[model samples]
Each structure stands twice: as structure tokens, then as C-alpha cells.
Target chain A: MKVAFPYFGYDTIALKNFLEMLGAEVVLPPLPTERTLSLGTKYSPELICLPFKITLGNFIEALEAGADTLFMAAGARKCRFGYYHFIQETILKQIDNNVDFYPISQYTPFEFIFQKMPKIFSVSPARVMKSINFLLAHSRLIENFRKLVRQARVIDFTLASIHEKHALEIIADAINLMQIRKARKEIKALFNFADDLPENIIKVGLVGEIYLMLEPFANHDIEKELGKMGVLVLNNRSLYRHIKHLLHIDFDRIKLNHRAYKYLKESPGGEALNTVGEARTFIKNGVDGIIHIFPFTCMPENIALEALQKMSDDYSVPILSLSIDEHTSKIGLLTRLEAFIDILKRVKNQKAVSRVPRSSLLTPH
Target chain B: MIKIGIPRALFYFRYGEFWQHFFRNLGYEIVVSPSTNKQILEQGLKYVSSEICLPVKIICGHIEVLKNQVDAIFLPRFVELNHGLYTCPKMIGIVDIAQIQVGNACEILSPKIKDNFMLAHFQTGLKLTGNPIKVIKALNRAIPYLSHHKKLSNSEDHKQRILLLSHFYNLWDDFIGKDIINSFQSCGFDIATKEDLPDKVLKSDKGFAKNIRWVYERELYNAFQYYSDKVAGICNIISFGCGPDSLIGEIMSKQANEYKTPFLQLIIDEHTSKTGINTRIEAFSEIINRNYQSKPYLTK
Candidate 1:
């Protein structure tokens, strides 16, 4: 069976490997482009969030590449994400009648491992467990690669870009757990510029909707742009953490909710609580600033923006919120980023100047 | 007597009468904000981000109107209404928004409605009355008023009938939806809404209906499933920027296409003009009439 799924930034390699291990010929969709966004926009409902449009575009591109089966993640609550597969499937069937659609629910891991995955691949549950283990290890490796890239980019963008390309190839080639472990060490050595990094570089917490956080295309490569500006972007959302969250083994979830309890008591269902929690934590840790990004019509994140505003007020932190959609211009986004970074730099410098003694300031060389 | 203010928007349309009765029975003066107006809409817009849906903006405006005049605002955080069925995320977070906006101006009596609706209401009642017995008595007195089983007017009198699919707030609110309802009625068409249908019709565990987990959205989907073949056409009134309606509207229109029934989606926002809605309603009625004339035997 020819299987296809949407592109999720660099972590697509992990999902592609997971599907391939199940003995299915996985057809990877071409990386998202202007053509993909336009195609998705042409067919999607006018007001649906950007992720839906992008994923729908991915499915269409995959179908063009001879994929007969489509797998999409589903079953989230209090967000439009859970209902994405139902609408996307209906729209897709009109384009191709012979395609098979399967919505892999995010919450039901047991059914996915024992029932759905085994039934679809005609494999034993034991094989499914092994594939899942491979997926987790691969995703963890990718997460580390992202951290190294984020750090190295702030030091040397050109050299980091070159290493990023080489590291991604290494991550994709590693199949077994031993290779994955060895690849992690190689990736770490490849980005070892710890001595070149400054002590007090400008750091900004990136918090928002998970899709916008993980998918660089959706956010117009904000992390790379920030790195180019000599700023460190700390993003905590990744497939590794997301999978841990779904399995209910994420220990940090309680602490996040506890930190966010003062501003937001209950989860509005998406990552709003997480966004608030992460922003508050970032502020407490003395980050220079915070950047909040989400789709234009996102309900939960918009609500989170309100709480973040209150938190920003109480903590005296500067926050820049970007509401992205198809209409958002790259030039405008960069201009806003530049202005926000300038403000953050000024704020950091002012605090530094205030901390030093007046005698030390007069004795500056 | 301590006065309790209830904004006449969102859930107020669904349970406004019950809340009024319950609060009055508990010996508190209940003050409901006036229906949505331009002033209220502008006030709501002032305090919120621009991307929020129109209904939420209007509710925020209503709260602004009643904040100073009352002792506390009765804004309940509706999390879940049925088992595994959640309200819209905005509905769940709106109480917090109201709290942030209305700060020390007024106290917000927000009871989180999760599994047991009666228990939440009783708790909110006790906050005002200070007596468990009085809260229970008031709840018992107002239980019957909570059932909003509205009957559709006789469908035989009109030559065409349209299923007016919309949430309770959008349909009943005079400023947001009254124009379209009036325009449809004036065009010699009878209208049926989700409120007119009984719980059995709305709770049908059919194909796509079973997948919908939002309580009100499920009702819209099931109503569309039931009336897709029976009605002459379907007109869905959704506020701009609503996350759930964006998907549900697409699903309904796709199904309406398969059923060969005419479909019209009217997107309303704070900037939506009255004449614009009336004009669209006029054009939609014409299309439905043409379809009816072409295939008289298809629709009953």
C-alpha cells in the first residue's frame, strides 16, 4: 500500500520512517511551497485555520505523486484540530475517489498501537510497538538537532545553515537505536561552538499554537530570521514533547499548569494554558522578551494573548504578538521582528546599565 | 436587594430565562443587559483583540453596559454540556476575558458547567443567597423553564420552507440575525431552526453526526442531516471568525451539494450592514424558489 502524510517541518523524517517500518511504501509529499499554499487555499473553507489549508495542500500534492492512502492526525478537544480529518477527507474524496483516508487520533495511543496500526499493516501488535519505539527515538534525535541549530545559528548563520543540512541527512540515514545515538553525538560535535557564544545574548521565548511553533513555513522561518538578528529563540514545542504529552508521561505539564493558574485557571483546550505558562516561566527566568504567534482565527491562542497581556503587565515584559494568515507579508513580518528585537536590546541594555555601580559606570574604558 | 447582572448574549439566550427565574426565586434582583446595539458592539470592540468573533465582542459590550450598574455579573464558564462534548474554546475562556476586562468594576459569578449542569447552577445560586436549601429550591423552581423546545410554525401555509441553521445567540439576537429571519419570512418562505426540533432529532447518532463533539455544533450537523432532503434549501448564519462554524459550514454545504439542496452561508460581523444581509437573503430566496419550481416533487 502506498501511504502519504502531511509535512511537519524537519520531523517528517521520523514519521516517514515509522510508516516505512510498517512495511508500507510511504510517499512523502513535496515540501510546502507557494504552489501548495495556493492550491490549499483554493479548495479549503474560507475561514479555516492555516494548518488545515497547508495539510490539505500536502494531501493533494501527495495524491499527485501516486499516493493511494492518506493518514492524518485527529481527535483533539476544544480546538478545530480534532475535526480537521473529517472535513479534509470530504474535500479530498471529491478530488480522488479511490484514495483511502485514515485519521490517526492523537489521544487514543492504545487503539492506534494495537487495533488501527496492526489492522492496517496486517502486522502483530509487537511489531507496532517496535515501530513506535523507533519513532520516539528518531523524534528525540530531531529535537536535539533543532536545539543545536537554534544555538549555532545565533553564533554563525552561514556555517550553521551548512551544518543543519548535513545534520538532517545524518538524522534521516539513522534507522536503528544505536545509529540514532551515534548520530546524536555526531550532531552535537558538528554544532559545538559553545566557546564562541556570548554570555548575555538576547533570548526570547517563542510560545503559541503548536502548529505555528513547529512548522517554519507557517511562521515564515521566524527562528532562522531571529537567529540572523543575533537573538536566541527558545521554542519548547516539538514532536518529541507532543508525543510525551499524549502518552501522559510529561512531568512538566503539571508545573506549567501551576504557573499559569494565577492568570488562567482552566485550559481553554488548545495550547493556550501552555502558552501562558511558558510565557510566565520565560518572564520569571528573565528572558529579554516574548514572541507569541498563531493563526489569525485561532480561538485558544487569541484567548491566551489576553492572559499573556495581563502577565506582561504584571511582570513588566515586552511581548510581540503576530497573527499570521495567507495575507501576511514577509516584509511586514521581518519589519515587526526587527523593531521588537531593537526594543528588547534597548531594554536589556538599560537594565544592564542600571545594575552596575555609578562609580563603575564612570570608570568605563 | 443585591442586583445580579447577566449579559444578554451568548449563553444568555440559551439559559437566560432559567437564570432570571432562579435568581429571582432566590430573592436577588436580576438585571439583564439590553439587546445588542451599536454602542454595546463598539464598547466590546474597545476591550478585546480585533480577531475575536462578533458574538463574543457583543457579549463583552453587554458586560460593559452592566458592569457598573450591578453588584456582580453572572458569567458562567461553560466547559461541557454533554458527555465528552465541549463548548467552543472561546466560550470556555470568555469568563476569564470578562474578568480581565471588568476587573474591580463588578464581581463575576462564574460557575464552571462541566458534567452536572444543575450542580454548577446550584453553586452559583448559593454564592448569592448563602443558603443551600434556598439554592436547591430555586433550582427546582426553574428546572422546567430551562427546556427551550420551540415548535416550528405550520409549514403547510408557505410554498417553500428553509432550514435556518444558526446558533441560539445569532438567531435570536435582534441586531445580528433578525434582519435575515424577517427577510426570509417576507419572501413567502417558512423557517425552521435547531430550537424547533426535539432533542431526539438533534441527538441522532448518524454517520458524521457521531464524530461531532461540540454540543451546539452537533445539533447543527444533525439538523442538517435530518432536513437536507426535506427542506427547500438551507441558510446558515455564522458570525465571522467562528472556528467551529468554519468547518461545520463547509461540511453542511458539501452535503447540501450532494443532496442537491441549495445552500447559503451568511457571514455576519460587527461591520456587516443590514441592507447587505437583506440583499443576500433576497437573492437566496430567489434561488430556492427557482429550485422549488424546477423540482416540486423533490421537496415536501
Candidate 2:
């Protein structure tokens, strides 16, 4: 069967690979664009969230490309996402009854475990075990990719300070081949050629929804852009942390992923806590600024933004809150990011300059 | 020595003075949080999850502002303040959620005030402090006084008929900002809110759309059913970024204007810039006044 998986974030790619490993022909939808937003706007209900419409648009596009089955993630959380499966399916079926829908939510210990297990593990215990193994292997691969990309970001910033000419090309190459393990190693070797920084670069913290922070396509490579501007980027989201969190076995110090535990303690996914806790950490760490990016109408992120806003004020840190809908354009977003970086850099420099003696401002009189 | 904290939002706009007066008469100290501000909004956001409507956010923010300062914050868990009339589910959950989130730092005086069943318990507490006879007499006097107050407020002429077409604040009393209602009354417009409408709107089918049966939308439907023709014009006050209000307000505005009635869409926030709200209201009132003066409808 030709299955279509609608893109949510960088994690979607990993999921696609995992599905493909099961011998299913997986068709991935293209990255969200204006056409996608337009399609969503035209078909979806006016009051539903922006993500719902975008995903619906993606499903339609994927269907047009000859994919028959639709895959959507389902989670039992306080957010309306629990009902998303039913609502989206109803809406999609209303549009076209032929599209087959499946929700990938078997990982949780819920009421569905007993009922759905027979269907999921129907082939054999061995087959199910193999599928599970495939998921674990692909998850590790994705985690490795995340670490490499983060390393590439650090290298890009360092290279920008020394050799601005080759910085963009090097970073772009690293980013394009981020998913490939061999390419990540080669990119690490290229970074050795970069000259040492004159001084420690200003560090800015990135916080918000997992998808917006982790995925390049969602936020338009915001962290990468910040690195290119010679600013160090700190991102606290990855598939490894998420999987570790879902294990419900906190084997580390304090026995929990503090970010996931605090926010998700109330909700199953721990989505909100990651943003709020990260904001608190970033402020304490003396980061220059914090950025909160989430898809528009995301409830958990909105709550997190509110908490982060207060945290920012209490700690005397500035926060840039950006809501990315399907309508977010690449050029416009980058230009805004450039302006934000310019303003933040100027402010940081002025603060540093002010700390110097007034006599330095004068003629050493 | 009970420091009762009343959030200056929702019901504060309508019953604030009454509650303040009643509590003071009963010898309870009051420490109201300052009128809604960014700090309150921030605090609300801190305590509440994002799925809650903006009004709930505003209320939680108010509670957060008074978290440590009060002996107990009064959040009356009202199902039916009057017989047959009811509150939204969000409002019913406020006291429980507030208790859970705020915890030992703040005491939640959860009075099930729907039928005023706690009146005897409240009197018993008062009796512990003084003469039982005096407490009985006080209750005797207060019962009628409270009922008269409710009757007077519920009466059409004294009550400003404001069709409060907004999102549900879990603490309905805190969302409407009784102070704003008082300000409106002080400004000579009787404040009538959605809660004052009949229960028929809750049952009436929109038949137009199956998905339109949401709680807040039903309240809007109730507002339209009760006061679209009776009132001068519907002042559709909504908070910015509220999802349902954007559509409902627009639809109601069109419906109002189509009926040749004046309607105003006032977007409220934590900012106390009453200038914009007042100006919009004034413009709307002026148009209503003009329409009234030009018509034969006022002849009676």
C-alpha cells in the first residue's frame, strides 16, 4: 500500500524512514508553503488551529501525489489534540470518503492498548518486535543527526567569526547532509579548519514548541541563521530527550528530564514544561535573548509563552515571541530574524561598553 | 481578620460593590487585587494551561496577584445562582482548579452558592464569634436584603442590559470586571450580561451548523435571542485573539446591523486604556440615540 505521511517537523522524516523500513512504500509530503496554507484556508474549518489546516492541506497534496493512506499522530493529552484524530478524520472523510486514515499512538499506556494491540500485533509477536526494533534504530539515527546539526551550528558561528566567506557554504552543506552519518563526520572535519574566535560569542537561547525549535523547515532554519550571524545558539530539544522522557524511567540525576517532567507532569507529552523550563534556564545562564516559536493556535505553547514572558521580566531578559503559521514565508521570516539579531547584538554591545570606565569614553582625562 | 480577595474582573463589574458592601457589613476585610494589568495577565498565564479561554487567563492572573496576601480568595462555585439559570462548565471548575493549583498558600472559600446552601454554615460561623440570636437576626435581615439586591439588579431598569458576548472565564465573577460594569452604570448604561438571559438559548438549535454548539457560542446565541431587538444595540465586547469571538462577533455584528440597529465591537485587554473602549461605546450609543430619536418606536 502507498502510504502518505504528512509532515509536522524534523521528527516526521524519522517516522517516514521507520515506516519505510517496514516495507511500506512511504510518500512524504512537500514542505509547507503558501500553496499549502491556501489549500488549508480554503477547505478546513475557519476556527480550528493553524496546524490542523496545514496538516490537512499536506494530506490533500500527498493524496494528489498518489498516496492512499494518511498517517496522523494521536496523543491522550489535555490539549484538543486528543480529539484531532476524530475531527480531522471526519473533516477529511467529508472531503473524500476514500482516504484511509490511521493514527500512530500505540506507545502510550491508555485504554486503547488492549483494544488496538490485537490489530497492531496481528501479524506475529516477532513482526511487531521487528517493527519496534526498526523504530529504536531510526530514533537513534535521528538523535545522532540532531547532535551533529547542533555541532554544525556551533562550528558555523565559530567559522563566521574567522572566515565569513566559507561560513555559509560550509554550514549549508552540513545542514543539507545533516541526516547522513558519514556527511556529519566530514562536516566535523571541515570545522577543524576554522580559526579560533577572537572572544567568546554572545549566546542566545531558543525555546518554544518542539517542532518549531527542532525542525529547520518550520522556523526557516532560525538557529542556523543566528549561528551565521556569529551568535551561539542553545537549543534543548531533540528526539533522544523526548524518547528518554516517554520511557517514564528517569535514570539520570534528579530522575527526570527536568524540562519534560515539570511541564508534561500535568499533561502526558511534557510539551509546555520544555519551553517554560528552558526559558528559566536560559535567563539564569545569562543568555542575551530568548526566542519562542510555535505554530499559531498551539495551546500548550501559548501557556508556555505566558510563563516565559513573566520569567523574562523577572530575570531582566528580552524575549521575542514568534507564532509561525503555515503562512510564514522564508524571506520575510529571515529578514525579521536579521533585524532581531541586529537589535539584540547592539543592545548586548552597549551593555558591555557601558560597563567600561567613563574615562574610556573620554580622552583618558 | 479574614482578608477576602476579589479579583477586579468578571462579576466584579456587576456584583463587586454588592459583594464588597455585603462582606463589609458582615465584618470581613477585603483586599482586592489592583485592576487587571500586564502583571496579572502574566500571573494568570503562569498558573493556567493555554487551552483555557482568555477570560479564565485574566481570572487566574487576578488570583495569582493575591495568592499570598489573602486569608482566602472567594471563588463561589455557582451552578445556578437563580432557579433554572446556570453557569458554564468552566466557571464550575474554577474553584476546584484554583484550589489544586494555588494550594496551601491561598485558601479558597468555595461556597456552593447556587442555592445558598451555605448560608446556615456561614451563620453558624458568625454565631461562634457572638450571640446566636444576633446572628439569627442578622441572617433574617441579610436574607431579604440579598434577595432584594438580586431582585433590584435583575430588574430591567436598574440593570444595564449589556450582552456580554465574550469567552468563558472560569471565574465568571472575575472576567467581566464588575468595576467596568459599575463604570458603565456610573456612565448611565445599565449593564446586562449573557448570564441574565433565559435557558432557552441553551436548548435552541442553530440547525444551521452542527459544529456551532459550543458553550460560548450558545451563550452568544442566548444574548441574541434575549436582547437583539429589546436593547438599543448589542455592544459585542470581546478579547483580542479569542477564536470563537472573532467569528461570533462578526456574525452578530452583521445580524445587528442588518436589523438596522447599531452594534459596536470592543476588544478589551489588560491595558486600562478606557479611552478606546469608552470612545467606541460613545459612538455606538450616539448612533443608537440618533436611531431612537429619528424613529416612531420611541412614541410609546
Candidate 3:
């Protein structure tokens, strides 16, 4: 099968592995842009969050590019996102196009295959168990790969403090080249470089949907701009987190990410839980402030913003809510970002910041 | 006397007269925000932190405009009116969110409706008014007052019918003329609406009443149920960027599948086009005259 993965708001690293492992030629969605938004606008309901539109656009474009088997993970949360898979299915079917959808939701089809391991593998239960044991043993491969990625982040966050554009780019490229090795010599070099960063660097936290947090274009290169201003932007999210939350549904995950699949199932406002959790994490980590980005009409973010006011007031960690739509102007966004950075800078210089004791913030219900 | 501020949004547009009359009958002063305008919208946007939908933004704007002018603001936290039919989560959460977001320090009224009680929970009214008799009296007067208005609305001779399906603004306001009904009448059409129906009658209808409190669906059912044979064409007006309307609008449009009557689904926004709206109305009116009235009503 020619598999297509949604380029939601981040780089498709794990999706590439999944598709390639499944013995399929993978095609990613077109890079998000004004054009991508327009394509989604043509078919999707105008009221849906921008991410839905972008995802719809990606699915359509991928299908047009002769890819089959569109993969979408269904979430159950207070966020309307959980409903996107169903909505997209109806829309795609209504378009009368023959595209196969492989939605990986709460009850994945893979469950059946995994459950009937011996039958599918045509081996004895003992042999299947042995193979499962082997896979579990080397599940270390995924973990090792994950740690290498984390190390890259530490190196990247450190280099971002240098405020040298070209040098940072070189560091990023080098870090990317570092292979996932248990005893990799490069990991130590990167760690040493990170430990040498200046003590005065201000750290700003970015909390939002995985897509918006990672996708520079969607958020107008916000993290980079913050980094350019000498702010160490800590993004506490990842594809691994997305997949991990998806594979093992947790109720508490909703409290962390109101947009998490499980919470979206229970209701629509739970995604805000994740937003609150992210802001709290940033506050706890001594980050200066948090920026929450969501597409216009994002229910989870709206709910999160409600909780954030109390969180921000109690934590004394200023939070800026940034919502993007097709009509969002880069100039306006930049101006707001500049203002927030100035606020963060002022607080850092004053050193008089009275971080609200954590107990004062809104406790998750 | 503690004055209450009622925002001229959402249910207020539809039930303003009943609400005002009800409260007035109880001898309490009512302060309503002026019609939605640029200044009002800006005032709300200023107070409301970013990242909410326009309606919520508009509500915030109303609150900003009315904040300090009243002792408390009424944000009807409508959970469900009829069984299983629910209000949008935005409506349910808006009161709590608004209280937190603005930190206005003003009192808010959230009428919790549950356990098959029809009135806005007499306890909530008692809390607001501080007298059980007054609450009961006010609620009693409001109920019949609403029924009377419904009768008047139903009996209206909508000569030049403009089946406005727009959001609260297009339905309630006569930017076309101050009174949408009068404006439609002047244009030679009778203005029929979902609110014009007697709730008792709808409840009596086993099928229609079953989905009665599903507000949007109820409106749609009312449109089809009462005025299907009378109106020229049903203009399904919806606001742009409304989430509830997404599914509700689709369901409504699909309801038009069998009704050979002229059905026009018009989407409204902050920036409305009078010319486009007029043209659509004209076309729909022409179609309704040609196709409707000649056919018999068929329930699907």
C-alpha cells in the first residue's frame, strides 16, 4: 500500500519509520502554507479549528498524489479534535473519492492483529511469545532512539542561547547527524557544550498542540524568534508523547493535555488540561513565561485559556495566548511576541519575580 | 435595589421581552447592553484575553461594556431545556470562564436547570431576588408572558415573509428596519420564527417535542413543523465560525432534501453583505412562489 501520513504540525519522523516498516512507500502532506489552508477551506467547515483544515488539506493533497491509507489517530477528550476522525471520514466519503482510511484511534485495527499473534505469524504460541519477548527486549531500540533525540534537544536548547544564527544551524545539523548509540562519544561532546551555556539566559516555555509547537511556519517561526531574542524556548512536547498517549490511553493525560485523545473522548474541554499542565511545568522549571498557541476555534485551547488565567495569576508566570487563522497577520503576531519577550526580559532583569506558590493555582477537577 | 445586567445576546434576543417583562413585573430594574457594534466589540475584545470564538468575544465585550454598571450579570448557563437536548458547552462554560477571565469582581447569575424543572431553577431566581414568593411570582408571570408573546408571534400576518435563518442579530435586529418582523412585512412577507410557536403545542406533538430542547434542531423542527406550508422559503441563516451550527446546519439542510420549498442556507459574519443578502432573498422568494403552495406537506 502507498501509505500517507498527515503532516499535522510537526516533522513526520516516527510516521516515516511506521510506514517504511509496514513495507509501504510513504508520502507526507504538502508543507503547510496559505495554499494548503485554502485547499482545506474549500472542503472543510469554516468553523473547525485551523489544524483540522490543515489536516484535511494534507489528506486531500496526499490522496491526489496517489497515496492510499490515510492514518489518523482518534482522540477522546473535551476537545472537538476527537471528533475530527469521524468528521474527516464523512467528508472524504462525501467527496466520493476512493481513498482508504487507516484511522488509528482508541480501538485500533492493529489490536486484532496483535491479539491473534500466533495466527497471523502462523507460529506456535510459544514461538510467538518468544518473538514478543525478543521485540520487548529490543524495545530498547525505540527508547535509545528517543534518548538520542532528547540529547539533541538539550544541545539545541543550549546552542540557542549563543544567539548566533549560523552557528546554531551548524550545531543543529551536527546534532541531527549524531546516531543513537548507547556509548556514543558525540553525546558527551554535546552534553559538555550544553553545560557551558551562560547562566543568565532566560528560558521561555512554548505550550500548545504538538503540531503548532513544532511547526515553525504554522506559528510564524515563533520559537526561533524567541530563541533569536536569547530566550531558551523549552517545548515540553514530542511525537513520542503524542504516540505514547495514543497507544496507552490515560485519564490523567487529559489533565496534562486537554487535547489528549482520552480527554477529548470524555468531553471537549479536557485538552486545556494539557495546556495548564504545560504551563505549570514551565513555571516549575523556572521558565520565564508560557505561550499557548492554537488555531482559531480550538475548543480545548479556549477551555485551557480559562484555566490559564487563574494559573498565570497564581503562578505569576505571564501567559500569552496566540491563535492563528488564515487571516492571522504575521506583523500582528510578531508585535505581540515582541511585547511578550519584552515582558519576560523585564522580569528576568528585575529578579524580583515572586513565583506564586504552586498550591495557589487552579487544581484540576 | 440590586440591578441586573442582561446581555443582548444569545437567548436574550429571542426571549428579551419575556425576560425583561418578567423581571420588571418583579419590580427590579433591568439594564441591557446596546446592540452589538464596533465600540462594543472592541470593548469586549480589550477585556477578553485572546483565543476564544467570536460569540464568546462578543459576550465578553457586552460584559466589559456593562461591568460596573450593574450588581450582577445574567449568563444563563443553559444545560438542557428538553430531555437530551443540550446547550453548547460554550454556553454552559461561558459564565464560569467569563468570571475567571475578566476577574471583574461583579456577581454572575448561573441558573442550574436539572431534574425536569422548567423554570430557571427557582432557587437561582431566589438567590438573585432573595424572596421565594417574588421568584415564583416573577417566574409565573414570565412563563405566561412568554406564552402570550408566542401567541402574538404565531398570529402575526407575515405578508412579505422573509424566513431569516441568520444568527441572533439577523433574526432579532431590523438593521433592515429595527423590527425584523415589521421589516419583512414592509417588504411584503410575513416573518415567521421558531420562537413564535407555543411550547405546549410543540410538546403536544410527540415527535417534535421529543427533540424540542435541542435548541437548533428545535428551531429547525419549528421552521418545518409550523411554517412549512405558510412561508415562501425558509432562509436558514447561520453565523460564520459557529461550531454548533456546523452539525445543526448540516442536519437542517438535509431536512430540506424532501421539502420542495425554496431553502437557502445563508452564513452571516461580522461583515455582512446587504446586496448579497437581498439577492439571495429575492431569488429564494421567487423560487418559493413557484415551487411551494402548489405542493402538499410530506413529513419524512
Full-model lDDT for every candidate = 0.90, 0.60, 0.60
lDDT for each residue of candidate 2 in A202-292, tens digit (9 for 90 to 100): 7778887775676665678887777677667787777556655555432441322374343323321226656766777777778888888
- Which 10 consecutive positions of candidate 2 chain A have the poorest summed lDDT? A168-177
TM-score of chain B of each: 0.96, 0.60, 0.77
What lDDT score goes with residue B154 in model 3?
32
The true-structure Cα RMSD of candidate 1 reads 1.8
Candidate 3 DockQ category? incorrect
**C-alpha displacement of B159 in model 2, angstroms?**
22
TM-score of each: 0.97, 0.60, 0.69
Best by DockQ: 1
The positional error of residue A365 in candidate 1, measured at the CA in angstroms, is 9.5
DockQ for every model, please. 0.77, 0.07, 0.18
- TM-score of candidate 1 versus the correct structure, residues matched by position: 0.97
Question: How far in Å is the alpha carbon of B214 misplaced in model 1?
Answer: 0.6
Ranking by lDDT: 1, 3, 2
Spell out the clash pairs found in candidate 1: none
Q: What is the lDDT of candidate 2?
A: 0.60
**What tens-digit string does per-residue lDDT give for candidate 1 at A1-365?**
89999989888999999888899999988889988999999999999999998999999999999999999999958899999998888889989999999999999999998999999999999999999889999999999999889999999999999999999999999989999999999999999984377978999999999989988899999999999999999988899888889888888988998998887768898899899999988988889999999999899998998999988888899999999998898999999999999999999899988998999878959
